[model samples]
Structure formats: structure tokens, C-alpha cells
Target chain A: MTAAAASDTAPLLPAARLRAALLADRAATLTQLYRRTFPAVERHVRRHGGTAADAQDVFQDALIVLYEKALAETLTLTATPGTFLVAVSRNLWRRELQRRGQHPTAELTEAHFDELPADESEAAPALAVLDYVQQLGEKCRSLLIGFYYHRQPLEQLAAAHQYGSVRSATVQKFKCLERLRSAVRAAWARTTDLLTA
Target chain B: MRPELTRLQLIEQHLLGPATPADASAWQLQTLLDPDLAADAAAQQQLYAGLQLAGRQQLRQELQLIHRQLYGPGSAGWLRGAAAGLRSLFKRRFRR
Candidate 1:
């Protein structure tokens, strides 16, 4: 079945509602969002010589970008999520094609491209830092990610992590941050040393 | 805590803007006295940035799982039911 036809019954969600659900990282909202937007992404990918698998990959990446932007409260949606997703998916497909030394046959308007998500490459440095953070042990990873990234409260973090109290959780969180900071510094120093040497 | 660890905690408090004026001044003085501490402060900032990326990556993984559960082959559950609901809705409207 055509992607467009599949979404006939699924209505476009209000931007505010979609943003809230995304920020909360709700699975039900995300599933409904996928149903509402994936069709547009798939159609765009297919028209551009991508297969279903390619469409899925491109759409998933786009959704992740959207999730990041929404979590940061930075997404400003001038159109419905479908339109936005299609725009972002198109950008992703274009980059994918370029990486393969191919070009999109269909031209998108400058306005359309402008509304799409920022270049994924812009996040490469931060992504690289994350590559290091993942190498940290599970406790460090969870503590840092929970307090800093997820913005979990110290009391909840204490109970979840089985810390003695909020005070201890706060101390542990800072220590994990210190560990992460030291690791990042060491990595940076090594890279710079390599470059200069 | 060791002096360095206490200093690190103080820097953390300073950066997070909850450090008292006296503590902030002390952190400033400490970073000034030791270039290494200044570098640590900068690394601390980058570490926070990395933490943000890590957190987002975790969320992305969670979202990916949700995607797999809903759309993966051999999947049967509420997601499948939702799909079926949509198909029937479309079928009923098309029958009109």
C-alpha cells in the first residue's frame, strides 16, 4: 500500500501536543507520530531512488534529530510533523545520496531545505564526545546521563541508583561528572599531542 | 573528599551557578592559581556537552526500540492493533 494511503485515518497532531509528547519521550506518542509521518518520509525516499530499507533508515535518523531538537525545546515547527518529517527526510536522503556520489533528480525549493533540520555533521564533535562517554562504565554512564542529560531529580536518582540519600546522589553525580571531564580532557590532550607531534 | 575533588565539586557548583559568592571566588582563585585547574574547568564544560549527547543518544536508542517493536516483522501487539484500526478506518471510508 502507498504510504500516503496508509495514513488516511491518522490525523496530523498539533505542534504543541507533538512537542510535549516528544519531550516526554512517550512511546505511544512516538508510535502515532511514526504512523502519521513515516508515510511522507517513505514516499520521498522512494521517489529519490531509495528502497524501503533506505527510507526506514533515513526516517529513523530524522526522527532522532527531531527528538533531540524537541528535547532541547529548540524545534520550531511551521508545518505539520509530516511536512517537517518529509523535509528532514529529504535532507537526509540528499546527504546519503551525496555520500554515495549521487545527486537527487528532484529539486527541492530553498524554503523547503531551509525548514529542514540542521546538518547532521554539525553534531559530529558532540557525537564523538559521546563515543567516549559510552566507554565509561555503566554506573558512570547512567549517573551522568541521568542527572545531566535526562534532568532527573537527585532524590529520584538516589532511590533509583540506591544511593544513601539525595546528598549522596548529588555527590556521586558530580564525581561521575568529574570522571567524565577527566576522560574528555585526556582524550583531547592525546589528540592534540598526536596532531602536534 | 581530597582537596582536588573538593575543588572539582566547587567548580561544579560554580558552573551550575549555585555556588555562594565566597565559594565562587574561591573557585576562581583556585583556577587562577593552577593552569591545570583552568583546563579542568574547560574540560568540565565539554563533559557536560558530552553528557547531553550521551543522554540524547540513550533517548534515541529508546525511540529506536519503540520503532522496532511497532514496525518490526513478526510483531504483534498494540501497535499491530493500531495498524489494524487504521486499515479498517480507511476501509470503511473507502466503502462509502
Candidate 2:
């Protein structure tokens, strides 16, 4: 089938379904999103002096932003999911241009693109925190992420991790969180010290 | 629950919850009166935000794997396969 025909027949997931897919990390739905939305992002990026590779990077970051919003349960789609992805890609590419000290192409006017909400601006620091999360060791990392990120219940986590009971799992989760908090605080302190020094 | 764990749970509830107005008010008053509690609350809030970021990171990795499976070097996608074939054909012809 032609690309257009394929897209025409593609199942467009509704907003709730999209959010659910993101929350569950469902590969099929996410793959469908990529197939449906990426071409438009690629075209827009190429038109604005970006390579296919640039488009890929911007599109990936946009998806991360969308995923974050979904995790926060704050995703409110104002248009088709494809259009939202394209708009986010546009914003991201525009930022990339500014970072590289190049003017955005005239076609990338502010009027033509949607400004992402302020919460999206926290992405960079959040990524840094993600690095800290990686340092939290495997057990703590899994426990914390399973609870907070995956939203898994204590009983389920207990079964998966072989904890004696839900109570033990809850205690473990609390301890892991405390460890994470301490580690992050120490890391932040070191960073702050470096800045001062 | 232990006192510290109970406090942590309260802070978590305030940060991410199910927190009732009364619970919120109590949390605010406690944090206001106790600087350490306030700091702990902030750190806990940051942790939740970090968890969301980590979740996004995981999802991004998953999407990237899907992208590679669909379009990367060894992908079975027809366009990429055709492009690779054409490139090799040109290289072979030029080298002759």
C-alpha cells in the first residue's frame, strides 16, 4: 500500500488510549505512534535546515516530553496526537537551533508553532536526576521505579521481588526512597560546591 | 509504622495524593514550623519528579528500540533495504 493509504487506514488511538499506552509502556501503541507521527516531524525538521538524524533526535525528545506528561496524568491533547507530536518537534527543533547559535528558519515562526507548557521545561534537570536514579543500585532502582514509575502495587512488587509480604515490600520501598533521597542530595551538594569553587 | 516512615508517607501524600484539604493544611503548617520537615518534603517531591523522568527515559529507550527495529541498519523495511542495495551497487560499479 502507498504510505498515504497505509496512514489513512492506521488506527488512531484516542487520547485516553494513548495515555494508557504510555503509562503501561505498551510497545504496539508506541510503535503505531511512531509510524503515524514521525514522517511529519521529519518533514518539518528537514524544511527547517535539519537532517533526518536531527528529526529523529527531536522526535525522540518530543516523545519523552509526551511520556512525562502522560506519567504525570497531565496530558490534555488539544489536537490529534500526530499534530501534537509535530508541534512538540517544532518547538524542540527551534530550541536546538537556538542552542546551536543559528537562527530558526523563517518558516519556523512562533505563530506557526505551539509553545510547550512550562512543566516541559524541567526535562533537562529531570534527566540529570534520572542519572542519579541509575546510581541507586539495582534493587533500590527496581523497587522505587516499580512503585513510583510503573505504579505497581506493593503486593505485586512483593511477589515479583520475593518479599515476604506486602508489609515488607512497603518497608523496602520506603528504605529505597530514603536512600535515593540521600544520594540525590549529596550529588546536588557536590554540584553546588563545584559551582561555588 | 515507624515514626520516620509515617512522616515520609505523609510527605508523599502531600506531594502526590489523595491529600485532603485538612491533610494539606496540616502538612503546610508542619513544614512551616519545622525547616527539616520542609526540606524533606521538597526532597520527596523532587524524587517523585525524578521517577517520572526515569519513566520517560525508559519509554524513550523502548521507542528507540522500536525505531531501530523498524528502520535501522538491519531492519527489514523495504525502503532501507532498497537504499542499501542501491548504495552497494554504485560502490561495486565505481570500484570496477
Candidate 3:
């Protein structure tokens, strides 16, 4: 999308604006999106037999799913961002209710649920591997997060992290990823060995 | 650089999508001939997945920080009021 088009339409809604902001260094836009979108999510969860804490948890999880989709370049909302968030939050809460052996209200149905581009099952391993990543060193931790998750441009990333150049930063990022890869590989091996034993 | 790390850097370039068209085709041919390279490529994909998880965790923390800032101590907003209302309701029920 052209920068002019993005800028012109950004203030229209949080959902439409979030994609552009996330692709660049625009934290203020993110904050605005969160603030504007979250209250509706909270109201939805609360009206559906959930507490404020439950709303917070559900909203955070939904936001994570939204962020992941945005990063993967696959999030397209049919509704406004707030409405989309409410639908996701409702689906998540219904699932939570089912898991707890409580019946979800008939009001909550899949008709309004936006089809996620990826399956929850596919996200399983991504959520599963987070525990292993926490054990990585500070530099490796930050480097991987900055490069892969945040999508920081290499030039800015190098300057922020004080790498001599983009090439060095790129090399360092790969090295950090390699270290994380090995650690995750080792952890999987241990789990497999335990399962087989 | 060791051969293995060099191979990883090459895979990273491919995964990151900056490889020249010719270079990517060459790497594809190399993967076809070399099982080890293919295996490493698959493993590298998994590594990217893991990194995505790491990134999500970082973003979650940052967001939760924002949540706290918006609703934490000394804050008075709709969210804070909502939270306080819930706390009192739960507190009253538990006290009974």
C-alpha cells in the first residue's frame, strides 16, 4: 500500500491503522489502537459472565493472535478492529467456557467469528516453545525478538543495538537464531527421549 | 566461519527473502542434492517458528506493561474503575 493512502486512512480506525504502524517505528499508534480497541473487548467479555480479570486475559490473548496475524501478513478484518476483537474475544471465551464444562450462551456463535488465517493447532508449537526461549541470554533474546517479532529494519536495529553495520547486525541476528535453534532442538530431543523412555 | 554456521547464514538469507533469484535457485538445487542441507533448512524453519514465539512473548510483556500503566496504581480511568468494581464484587461475595 502507498504511504499516502495509509496516512490518509490511518485515523479512520484502529484496525486499518495498526498494520502500517506495526510495520514501522510507531509505538504511539499502537498505544492508540490498544486503548481504542480494548474497551469494547472488555465489555464483551464482561457481559458474557466473565470478570474484569477474565476480560484482560481474553483481550491480551486475542491481541496476541491479532499481532501474530499482522506480523505474518495475513490479518484482514471484515469488521472494525474493535468489533473484530470482540468476536475473537467471544470465541476465545466460549472455548474457555467449554473447557471448564460450562455451556457457552447461544448468543455467542461462530457466525460473527472472523476466520483466522492460521489454525490454533499450528500456533501450538509457537506457544509451546516460549518456555525454552526464556532461558536464552539477554543479547540473543533481544536480537531474535527485534529482528523476527518486531520486524525492525536492519539499519535501525544495528544502530539501536550498536552493531558496527547492518551486515554485522544481520550476522549477529543469525548467530542468535542459531543459538536459539540449538537450544530448542536440544529441548525437543530431551522431551522425545523422555517420552520414548 | 565454520561450515555449519555458514550454511545456517545462507538458509537465513533464503528464509528472510533477500536472496537473489539466481542464488535462491542455486540453493534449491543444492537442497535437492544434499539431504543434510535440506534437513538444516527444515530445522532452520523451526528455528524461525521458535523466534516468532519469542517475539510474541516479548510483545505480550510490552503490552502487559502498557496494561499496567493504564490501569495500575494511581490510575483512574474506565478500565481502572471497571477493575475496581469487579474487585469489590468478588470481595463482597467471598466475605459472605
Query: How close is every model to the real structure, measured as TM-score?
Result: 0.64, 0.68, 0.70
Q: Write the per-residue lDDT of candidate 1 for residues A74-189, one digit (tens) a residue.
A: 67788776777778888878877775664345332111222334433465666667878999889879888876765555665687799998888877876776776677678778
- Each candidate's chain A: what TM-score? 0.62, 0.63, 0.68
Please name the candidate that would achieve the greatest TM-score relative to the true structure: 3
Write out the backbone clash pairs for model 2: none
lDDT of each: 0.69, 0.73, 0.70
Off by over 4 Å in 1: A1-20, A23-25, A80-82, A98-132, A153-159, A162-166, A182-197, B1-6, B9-34, B76-83, B86-96
The CAPRI classification for model 1 reads as acceptable
> Highest lDDT among the candidates is held by which one?
2
- For this target, which candidate reaches the highest DockQ against the unseen true structure? 1
lDDT of 3 by residue, B1-96 (tens): 556668788787777776688987888898888878877777777666766766765776877777776765655666666887899999999999
Off by over 4 Å in 3: A1-17, A23-27, A77-79, A98-132, A184-197, B1-3, B13-28, B77-96
- What candidate 2 gets wrong by more than 4 Å, as runs, is A1-13, A94-131, A150-168, A185-197, B18-20, B32-35, B78-96
TM-score of 1: 0.64
Considering lDDT, where higher is better, how would the candidates rank from best to worst?
2, 3, 1
Count of backbone clashes, every candidate in sequence: 0, 0, 0
lDDT of 2 by residue, B14-70 (tens): 877876889878877897788799878767777887877676567668878988876
